[model samples]
Target: MSDFPSIPRLTSSKYFSSLLLLRNIWKGGDLSDDMQFQRVVNQRTYKGELILFAFDLCSVSDALNAVLMLRHVGFEHFLPLTDGAATCEALHALADVKALPTTPCFWSSSSNNHKGWDTWGAGAGCVSGERRRGYCKAEQLWAIRYHVAARLLASRVNLLHMDTDTVIFNDIYTRLKRKPISDYSLILLPESPVNGGLWYAQHTSLDSGAQWVIAEVARRTWEVISLRIRRRSSPPFDQAMLADALVSAMKGERHVAYMCEHPAVALQPPCANASQSRCAYRHYEWVVATLDARNATPLYRACFWRGDAIVTTDEHVIARKQRLVAVH
Candidate 1:
């Protein structure tokens, strides 16, 4: 038996039932009371793919820089999701003044409260001082992300969700198109052990294996954010939980396993290196493959300077990012 907590069946959980209601509500074209979300989605979606990222007031600058970088790289279809009205208004203002083609969507206060959780401040990491508070906000944001992704998947919309800290140098959709979409449910980007900061999801049925994986991740994330269980000393963030969930899903008899052959487009083979024992693993249908770090560089490296299309790491401090942008 796996050491991780057992995932409750989706059909039996009230949380999942709410997501189902949301899925149905969205299907009827009533995405939100304001109808702004539907309008944004309709305008931003490109070649059946939508790029998404979420941010709050504290991270608005980084989000704007990210948007600018993405646009600079010839990407036209992207949406920014924010929980705070202030953040949404700021993004709209900046986009309008800058003549940015993309519009942002705001979630009402009924959906989430941006003020309840403490902000990470300028130079702090997610689990900096007051680990519990920071972790709580991080967990909550991730839960919201998964919830949104689930709704999108239910509506049969393909999406690539990325973090604001990440920088793009090329078109990611063209790279993804190299693979056969029918063969995989999700494609992850490797960050040291693993990362949830960047990933791609294909449109899947409500009951498909991929949806089950997403539900399991969301379930665990919600458990942490809701305080249904006590927080552990070494808390597992969404990325770690996602990695574990993928491993567990792979162990199931119904899930088929495949070896990744192309390191650039898919995950490197398990035996690619003898020193990294964790790198040696098989992928299941739930997570078909991983995008190599060379193409999607994580924070620890300087792959952007070396010509990667996407770099996943960014300075947490606003001043640092601003200085770098000024110099560039």
Candidate 2:
């Protein structure tokens, strides 16, 4: 008999607690025996990797994309953010179809579990105004994501938090090795003038202070950032807050921020109507158009989220499905 504990071990979460990174709000709970994370010492084989991925799958299309990622762009191991049964199934089924050899197990955030009480407090007074509920809920969801991502920082694992909407064409690992993220506290690329789509944080020791900076960002938006959708400018979401926290922590010195522009490092499909005017995720036609245009370019990495857009409501994922069919 194996003398191992029967808990899904989350390395980063444990590291965070060990470092005392949660100076104020870290909550310690009894590990659930029903479904515990599979344990490994660090869960990473190499000492350092340029890009190890973590993806969120909360919807059907997101699952499809996870399959796409595994088939097209190989990932060693990733932190997964799955909010429900469908998302979980899709990730599990990834290896079964398309000649994938094995069903990969992954570590995930505890918040993905269902709740009886109102965990978010009606989106937490984060965003106020008429029609703000939807936006606020989105913010809260992302807040949890950041909260989860912080564990990776605590575990001292370099993580590239990519949305499922993003695609990869070129071999990114080979490229990043040419110019590594060794010096960067965070690797950020502007999705827009005021927004970012992807982030990379290096693995650092408990004393490096990088963990403190990442912790502050998560703490500020622990549950919500409340960036209203109607505003022309960004409304202080987690990305902005993270940038601000890093800036403050770095104290005007080099942020060690490797700011790579999109389309150069990777491809970010413009909204179908982008040539005419800017479009939000609500613009279904624009979303569909971007979906149609995905494979047109030789993209390196694709950041599919549009300014923190909602994943499910957009009707365009249907188009993405059709594209997959045609590929088959």
Candidate 3:
């Protein structure tokens, strides 16, 4: 028996159904419209690989800037996931004014009726304005993010999921493409000790072990959300949930590997050298690769001054992000 509380599968749960209802609301449940949306997603793919990210009205500016930076580095294909028609509309308008050639996939409730996200915290009357506005929290946003990623993976779409605050100096797609796909199911960047901000998920069939790994992570995500709703105390962040899920999988006898990819060296056992400054590990079909801190530093680190890809900014504040973009 599992110690974790029982939660329904994401695709079959009421929460998932509610999210779908919101997404279909804009099109009046038109099949053709859904087909067109799928076409748009496919059209944005570059050699079957695409970039995915989630944002809200609160973080739309950061999202737009992230898109611009991605394009500036020659990344064309992207799928920006967001909630609310206002946020989606604002994102498109910003993209148009900036000449960004990508479409955002809006899949959550609108400004007026946010019943869809009630279980995810919107029902608590959280108004979206800035990152720190109202009762809106990062965990709520992450709940939505993991759901979208799980849905995409279930549909066999390979993607590199990134946070909006990230700044890339090199062509990340080229670097990711070089990694052998058969070697791992997920490629993740380390944030402190847990994986967050940036990661890659490969397309996998419904019955594949890799898909099982994806489902496991999604399951943990829902569990985290459920706990947050039931308890008054703060719950673990999504990053912590991810870390726990991967660790559970490893303990369950799944194949996991760890390597330090920054120096372009061969895979070494966990902590092979006591003197090694940076190290990463992988799980079952999931691979955790660490980038040189100087190249992909997380927000908590002070190495962004000479970083190649700022994994993320400290907060969702737009002004600070804009300054970072200007400097880099």
Compare candidates 1 and 3 on lDDT and give the better one. Answer: 3
Ranking by TM-score: 3, 1, 2
Per-candidate clashes come to 2, 4, 6
lDDT (Cα atoms) of all candidates against the true structure: 0.45, 0.35, 0.45
Candidate 3, run of 10 with poorest lDDT: 319-328
The lDDT ranking, best first, is 3, 1, 2
RMSD of each: 16.5, 16.3, 15.9
**1-328, model 1: which lDDT tens digit per residue?**
1111222222322112122112212211123444655554455565556677877656767777766655444454566665544456766676667765444444433224432222221111232222333323545556556766666665566777888976643334444444343345566553333466776776455645555556567665443333322223222456655654454354331111111121221232331431221321322111232322122111222111223322222322221121111000
**Which pairs of residues collide in model 1?**
270-280, 299-313
Model 3 pairs whose backbones collide: 255-284, 256-283, 256-284, 257-282, 258-281, 258-282
Q: Write the per-residue lDDT of candidate 3 for residues 40-135, one digit (tens) a residue.
A: 445555555667787777788888776665544445456676644455777777767766443454543322123433554545324354235454
Candidate 2 per-residue lDDT over residues 1-328, each given as its tens digit: 1122322223322121212211221111111222232132133223443232333343434644543453333343444443333334565565355444333333233442323113432323232122322432444445546655565556566555566565544333332322333333444432233233455556444424555555655565432222222223212355545544444342322221211111221121211122211121112111211111112221111222344322222111111221110000
- Highest-lDDT candidate: 3
Clashing pairs in 2: 7-36, 8-36, 8-37, 9-37
Better of 2 and 3 by TM-score: 3
